[model samples]
Target: MTHKRKIFAGMSAIAAASLVLTGCGGGGGGDVDADGNVVIELAQWWEPELPDGALRGLMDQFEEQNPGIKVELLSGPYASTREQLVTGAASGTMPDVVGLDGAWVNDFAKQGAIADLSALMTEHDYDDSQLASQVEVDGSTYMVPAVNFVYPLYTNDALLADAGVDAPPSNRTEFADAARAITEAGDAAGTAMPLSLETPSGVQNQVMSWLWASGGSMLKDGKPDLTNDGVTETIEYFDDLYQDGVFAPGAFTMKEQDMVEEFTNGRVGMMVDSLAHLTMIRESNPDLKFSISALPAEDGYDGKRGIPYASWGLGVSESSDHKEEAWKLFEFLMSEDANAELASMAKAFPGNVASVPDFVEDDELMSQAFDIYQAGYPANEFTGLPVAE
Candidate 1:
C-alpha cells in the first residue's frame, strides 16, 4: 500500500521548535547534541517488565552499530505511557519512537500523530513479508507488531486443590463452579476481574476474551455488534458470577496489574492474564503454584477457540525531527535476532514470521501457552478501531 509521508515530513521548523520548547521530558527534544549525536526518544511500557537494564543493553548495541545516533528510553507503566503519549499527540510533541497498542493505531493515524509506516517501508525497501500482520489505518500501515502476548487462564493450583476442584476448568459451567467453590472454601475470591473504566483495558483484555473463548465477536462486518447473542450471553454469565460474589472485590476500579497482584498473592483462584506477566508473578511469589490453560469455552462447542492477544507494536511519531534515526531503532528491534530475544525475555511470541522465542522449549508453562495459541485463532476486535483505548 502506497501513501504519502510528506504531510508528516513537511512539518515546519518553527512548529518543531515550539514542540521542543514545551514538550514533556525523555528525549522530547529531538535534536543533535553538541557532541554531534542525534538523540531519539524511545517510549514504552516494555522495559519495566524486562530484566533491569536489559532493554537499555539492546539500545547500547544499536548505538554501537549506528555511531551517530543515541537512544533515550522513556519507560513506565502502560496507563502512564498512554496518558503521556495522548497528551503529546495532542500538542504535537510526541516522542521520536513509541511503543503502540493496536487499539490506539487508528485514532493516532487519523490525527496524523504517527508516521505512515507503509511509505517508510517502501522508501527503505524493507521486507514487509517477514513481519506478522500489521495495524493499518485507511489502507496505509502505521504500526508494526514487534512481539505478541496471548492471554490465558491462570489457575492457582493450591487454591483449586483446597477447593476440591480436580482440574482446570475447560468450559463455562466448570469454570463458574470452580470459582464458586474457591470462594466458599476460603477467603480468596474465585476470579480476579479488573474492570477499571479509567484504564478501560479490562473490557478489551478480560471481558471480551470470554466471548472470544467461545468463538464469538463484538464486531460483525467491521461494525459494532454488541447486541448479538454471543455478547448478550457473555454479559449475563459475568453478571451471574457477580451476583454469586465470586468476582474479586474492587473490580470496578481494578487494573490489570492489580489483577495479576491478586493472583500472585493467592487472593484469587483464577484469572485470564497475559503470558508476559509470568516472570513477574514467579519473581514476586516463588512458592505460589499456578497452571496455565486455554480460557473456558461455552460447553460442547468443540470448534477452534478464539485466543485473545496484544502486541508490543512499534511506530515513529509524526512530530519527530529525528525520523530517520527513529526508523533505524524500530528496524533493529524488528530484526529476527532482536525480536527473538525480546519475545523470550517477555515470555511472548515473536512478531517476525521467521523468529521463535527460545524460552518456550525450556519453560513448561510457556510451552503450554504456546500450544494453546497454536490451537486457537487470535481474536481481538479493537486492534484498529478509533477510540479503542
Candidate 2:
C-alpha cells in the first residue's frame, strides 16, 4: 500500500478505538466541573509515554494560580500525532490544547484547526519578537514556540590536530583541505557529509542550507528560483564532494544513527547533526575532544554563517470549550521559570527569550547551543519544490 493509504488506515483504527472508549464512558458528557473549573486536555507527541508528572506539576501550579482550571496530558507517537489531531478536529473531538512542530502550524492555522491568537497576544501583552522567528508565519503567530533544536557541525579536535590542523575550518575551502588531510593520514575516513539519497528529504534539507549560505533563496518575492546560479553551485559542490571520495562509501544508504556512531566512534572526522548528540558523545568518549560550530558558508558569501533551526511549539484547538483556561496554561508554560524547568526536564533548549538568563549558567552544552542559536538563521524546511494542492 502507498504511504498515504497506510496513514489513512492507521487513523481509521485510532478513530474506531477512540469511539469505543467514548461509548464505554457513556458518550459526550459535560467537560466542565461543578465548581465551574474549565478542564482542558492537551495532546502532545513529545514522548510515547506521558511526561512523568513533570507536566502535571506545571499543571498543578497553573491550577493554583487560576482556581477554576484543570489540565490533562495525553501523549502519543510523533508519526501519528498529526493524523490523530486532524482526525479529532474533523470529528469535533479535538483537545483544548495541542503540541505541534512549527511546520505543521501553518497548515493547521489555514485549515482553522487552531484559533487565531492575534487578539490574545494584545490582551496578554505577548510580543511576537520574544519567540523564535520560525514559529511566526506571515506576520500572524499561530503557536507559541516551546523548545528549539539546532543542527551544528561536530568536529573532533584531536583528529584535526593529529591530521596537522591547528583549528577548525570556518569556511568550505579550509574544510575540504582538512577532510582530505585526515583521510590521507588514515586517522579518519575524511568527512561524512550528510547526503543520504535513500531519504531524499534529508538530502533536500542539506542542499537548502548550502543554498541559503551561498546567498540564494528557494523563493524570491514569493516566486520559485530553482534556476539560480547559487542553487546550481550548491548542487555541484555536493557532487564534487562525493566524486572526491570525501563522503563515506555507500553514504546513500547510511541512516542518521549510523552517521552518529561513525563520528562518535572515531571513524569519521566530522559530522553534522543535532545538539542532542553532545550528551551522548561526551558520555561515550570522555577523552574525545570535540567542538560544535555553526555550518560553514561559501568563501565570500555574505550569508555564509547559517545553520538550520528546528523546533516544536504549543497551540490551542479552535474547537476548544475552555480556551481561556487553555491560554492561562499556555502563558504559564512560556514564563521564564516554567520554561527553564521544562527545558531541564526535557533536556531540550528553552523557547522563551527570558529563559536565556536562567540557562546561561546551567551547563556547557546549553551554553554552546545558546551561542549557536544567537548566530544561526531560521531553518529552511520549505526550501525545495512546491507542494501539490
Candidate 3:
C-alpha cells in the first residue's frame, strides 16, 4: 500500500519566540562503562508500549552497528515518565536522549532543558526535510516527531448492532443518536470520555477533538479563538451529550487509560482514541470486534476533517556530555528503515515522511486509519503550547 503524505496544515505552528527562562541545566550525560563503551541513557514511555523486547532488539541492532556505544532505556508509563522528566529538568539531571511530547518543547526549551537540534543537524549535516515536522521554540528546532498516533472513532460491532445502529456514525446527530441508543440497550455507555482535571490533556484529546473533527480551530492568527462560533457549538454539543446521559459514568475524573480499558472491556460502545492502542486492545480482548472511522463531523461539513494526533517525539538533553553520541542514536532512529520498523511495531504512522508502513496492507483497522489520515489533516493545536498538559 502506498501512502501519499498530507500536509500538516492543521497543526498550529508554535511561535513562542519571546518566551524566556533564566536557568540552564546540563550535566546528565552518561559515563564510560566497564567495557570502555560510551553509555547513553534514554528515557521514554515507548518501550513498554512496544512488543516485549522489540525496542531492546532495535537498540541491540543499533549497538551492533555503532560499535563502542551503548544505549540504556529508562522506560515507564506516560504519567510517571512526564513527572520524571519534569523533575529531571528542574534538577538538571535529564537523560541523554529523551522521548518528548510536542507540548513539552516550549516549556523545556524556555528552561534550556533540551538541546538545540538545528545546530546539531547542521553540525552532523542531517537532512531534516525528510522529517514529518520539527517542533520548534524561539526559532530553533527542539523536537522531532518519531511516530504519529491518530485519534479515530472506535466502535464495538456488537454494541452498535445490539443498539440497532446500521453503521458507524458520520455526523454529529447520528453520533448522538447512536450513543443514546447504545446506552439504552444495556449497561454500557454510548461513549467513554476521559476528562480528568488532574492531567487535563483530556480537554485537548476529547473536547478539542470534536472541534477539530468538524474542521474547527481553537486558534486564529496563532491566538486563542475560544469565543468563535465553532468552539461554542462544540461545547454545546458536549453539554447536550452530558445532559442526555450518553457519556460513561465518572467522566469528569476518568483518565485516558481508563477510557481505553472501558472500551476494551465492552463497557463503552464508541470512543475517539489513538491508533497506538490498537495492539493493546486486541491483546486484551482477542475475541472482541470493533471498527475504526474518522470522528463524526457536523451535519453539513464537506470539508477535510481535522484529525487529532499525538507523537512519540524525540530530543536530547541540553546538558548531556554525550550530545554527539546521543545524536547518532537519534539519527539511527530517524533513518527510514528504523523509523518504519518502530512505526510498524507500535502500529502507528512513521514520523519520517519517506517511511511508509507496509504492515497496514495486512491490517484492516490500520488500513482504515491510513485512509482517514490521507484524506484529512493532522489537527493538534497543543503541539507547541507552553504548560500544555
State which candidate, 2 or 3, has the greater lDDT.
3
Please, what is the TM-score per model? 0.77, 0.85, 0.80
lDDT (tens digit, per residue) of candidate 1 on 222-325: 67899999999999999999999999999899999999999999999999999878988999999999999999999998998888889999999998888889
What's model 3's lDDT at 89? 75
* Distance from true location, Cα of 221 in model 2, Å: 3.7
Alpha-carbon lDDT, every model: 0.86, 0.68, 0.86
Model 1 residue 370 CA deviation in Å: 3.1
Q: Candidate 1: which stretches are off by over 4 Å?
A: 1-41, 63-95, 122-129, 162-164, 184-188, 249-258, 265-267, 302-304, 319-325
Clashing pairs in 1: none
TM-score of 1: 0.77
lDDT tens per residue, model 2, 94-172: 6777887765776777667787777677777877566554344455567766776667778888788889988777777
**Displacement of the residue 343 alpha carbon in candidate 1, Å:** 2.5
Candidate 3: 10-residue stretch with minimal lDDT: 13-22
Per-residue accuracy of model 3 over 28-138 as CA lDDT, tens digit each? 757788999998988899998888999999999999999999998878788657766776677677888999999888888988989999999999999998887778766
